[model samples]
Target: MALVIEGEERISAPVDKVWAALNDPAVLKEAIPGCQKLEMKSPTEMAATVVLKIGPIKATFQGEVTLKNLNPPNGYTIEGEGKGGIAGFAKGGADVTLAADGDNATILKYAAKADVGGKIAQLGSRLIESTSKKLAGQFFSTFGEKVGG
Candidate 1:
């Protein structure tokens, strides 16, 4: 199934700082919910391992993330795909944009689309969507704190 999600966050940090944080693996690893490992393979690519629980299922996913459309301190598109052995596979992409709220703050907006296949897909869209939404929220909340601090 396919899912789409969108939201905006007001971050208490400069747009440039927020953009730097977004590209930092150390910062991303802390912000990402259930992220066990996140390593940059190149300037635009990263490898990751994440553990997640969805309803009655739990799985560890190995994934790769790519950043596209360079627009320093402004925005870009992030795409990723993950495999979870027998549990399934997931793939998604999000377009993220950042605007300055002030010299010391920024507004971040994102629109995401995702898909799942295999056992996880059988669980239904509601569950998957909710879980994805929750994870995304957690990431931004933590990210805001980390960068804003």
Candidate 2:
């Protein structure tokens, strides 16, 4: 199954600050729901371990996340593909953009696309899509709050 989600939020910080925070491993770890570990492999790559639950199914996913289309204080694309053993596998990417709102605030926008396959897909396509959207919402809201404050 495939799904897409889009959203935006305002952060009460300057564009540079917001951009730095978004690229920070610790910040990403905290912003990503159920993210247990995030190890920066290089400037644009990270290894992540995350545990997610969808209704009665629970899975731990291991993945490599890469940042692309870099433009300082502007935006970038983040993409990852994770394996969940027998449960399934997921691959997704998000394009995020940042714009300065005056000199003290920034507006963040993103559009994400996700796809899944295997047992999880067969049983929970709808659930997965809804859950993905919910998680993205939660992540961005928390990200904005954390950066803004």
Candidate 3:
């Protein structure tokens, strides 16, 4: 099944600082919910291992993430596909935009699309949808709290 999610958050930092933190592997590892390992391969590619729990099921996902559409302190598109062995696969992408909320704050917005298959999808749309939203929320909240934002 496919899911669409959108939200915005204001960070107490400049747009450039927020953008740099977004691209930094260490910051991303700390900000991303359930992220266990993250390695940057190039300026725009990363390898990640994340562990997630949904309802009564738990799974570890190995994924490769890629960043596209460079716009400097503005926005970019991020995509990733992960394999969870017998639990199945999940793939998604998001278009993220950033704007200045003020001279010292930035507003970050995202329009994300995701899909899951196999056992993960069998958990029902409602469960998956809620979990996805929760994960996204956790990431952004952690991000906002870090990097002085």
Candidate 2 deviant stretches above 4 angstroms: none
Task: List residue ranges in candidate 1 displaced over 4 A.
Answer: none
Candidate 2 per-residue lDDT over residues 1-149, each given as its tens digit = 99999999999999999999989999989999999999999999999999988777799999999999999889999999999888889899999999999989999999999998877787666788889999999999999888898
Per-residue lDDT, model 2, residue 144, is 88
Using all chains and alpha carbons, the TM-scores for the candidates as numbered come to 0.98, 0.97, 0.98
In candidate 1 the C-alpha lDDT for residue 77 amounts to 97
Tell me the RMSD of model 1 versus the true structure. 0.7
The residue pairs found clashing in candidate 1 are none
lDDT computed for candidate 1: 0.93
- Report backbone clashes per prediction: 0, 0, 1
Better of 1 and 2 by TM-score: 1
